[model samples]
Target: MSDQQENKVVISLDDLLAQAQLLKKQIDDLSAARAELLDSVASIEAAKASIQELKTQQEMLVSSDKKGYLMFKINNQPPQKVLVYLGLSYYVEVDMDTALKILDERENELKEASTGLDKKLAESKAAYDQIVDILNQIQAQAQQKGE
Candidate 1:
């Protein structure tokens, strides 16, 4: 092939700047999404910790004769609660067992969901960073052209 035909055409500065702006916006969007996921991860972590704490509390109750209960706080509002187990022979209480089972299932679901979201968020953030580097290189070349 001829030298002219073999070489790729160069992009204009104006076009480069425009593309940089678009890339910057994409980076910003990815950053925002990552922030939101971080919030979600925090929430999940808090929930996981709370669940573990509740389990500990439940175990404490099992060891004691008095029944134990759980308190829930939502939207910074009034607390809600549910009884965990009753006195004597902890296995005797079917209701408490069901409640524990449900909580366990829910915790597992939340953990899985958070993991998936975090993975996607990480991938998107990396992509955003790569685009930013490309934008910077293009802009740098464009600047060199004027000199």
Candidate 2:
């Protein structure tokens, strides 16, 4: 090939490699974000399970109590009311029914958010795979040229 043509080929290959590297970095960042989201989703599910357990316990206590007293402790004292977390370090004192309702709503929201994040993670992975395939093809072409 002519000297100018050869130079153009080399520059094109360099550009492709640079683009691939940038894409790889972006995919890594997305994967990290997705991992964090997965952790958050797991935590939310655990909280939901805990709330459900508490609700069940409260029901049992109310059913079995004959003297209008339930056996439970909070802060080393008898519990007064259920504390429902409202995010941002805020909490509200609520009855068992209200607490259960709030927990159900929060669980739904977490499920939706988890689904969205999963979709995004899948798309990012597919893009990363495509870039890797292109890079491999470029490397093979370069090897053939060298031969």
Candidate 3:
């Protein structure tokens, strides 16, 4: 009866280890998602700032390429309308005020998503820690039994 019980404990521990691996993966994925969302919010903030600056300035230097090896003036004429990306390769044309409002909404949504991911990450970490504590306890018991 003792041997049967030991076998069951070992099997249960193995199952727990598998679950820990899955939780670790989920934690990593959630962290990545949160980071991506934060990056999007930063990008939106930059866009909003650029638009505001353009409204006050006549022209600003801009790079035509990614490396910025070459540059030219944007020649902002206080754009009455601007194009805003709506995600998934979609965009919409709206007035300056409307574009700013839309960007604000997008930023808020991304921040909320990041917040939700943070909550899930915390829960996953707690569960993983609990599993690790259980495994450690079982290991300690096994060592004492062997001794």
The numbered model that scores best in lDDT is 3
Task: Quote each prediction's TM-score.
Answer: 0.44, 0.62, 0.83
Error of 3 at 88 (Å): 2.9
- Encode model 2's per-residue lDDT on 1-147: one tens digit a residue: 598776763436667667767767776776677677667667556655655666445432232253556653323333346788889999999876677688778767766776776777677678667767877988899999999
Error of 1 at 7 (Å): 2.9
Question: lDDT for every model?
Answer: 0.55, 0.67, 0.89
Against the correct fold, how does model 3 do in TM-score? 0.83
Candidate 3 segments exceeding 4 Å error: 1-11, 63-71
lDDT of 3 by residue, 1-147 (tens): 899877774457679999999999999999899889988898899889978987889997767775789998787587789899998999999988899999999999999888899999999999999999988999999999999
The local lDDT score (0 to 100) that residue 38 gets in candidate 3 is 88
Q: What order do you get sorting by lDDT, best first?
A: 3, 2, 1
Model 1: colliding residue pairs: none
Which structure is stronger by lDDT: 1 or 2? 2
RMSD of 3: 4.5
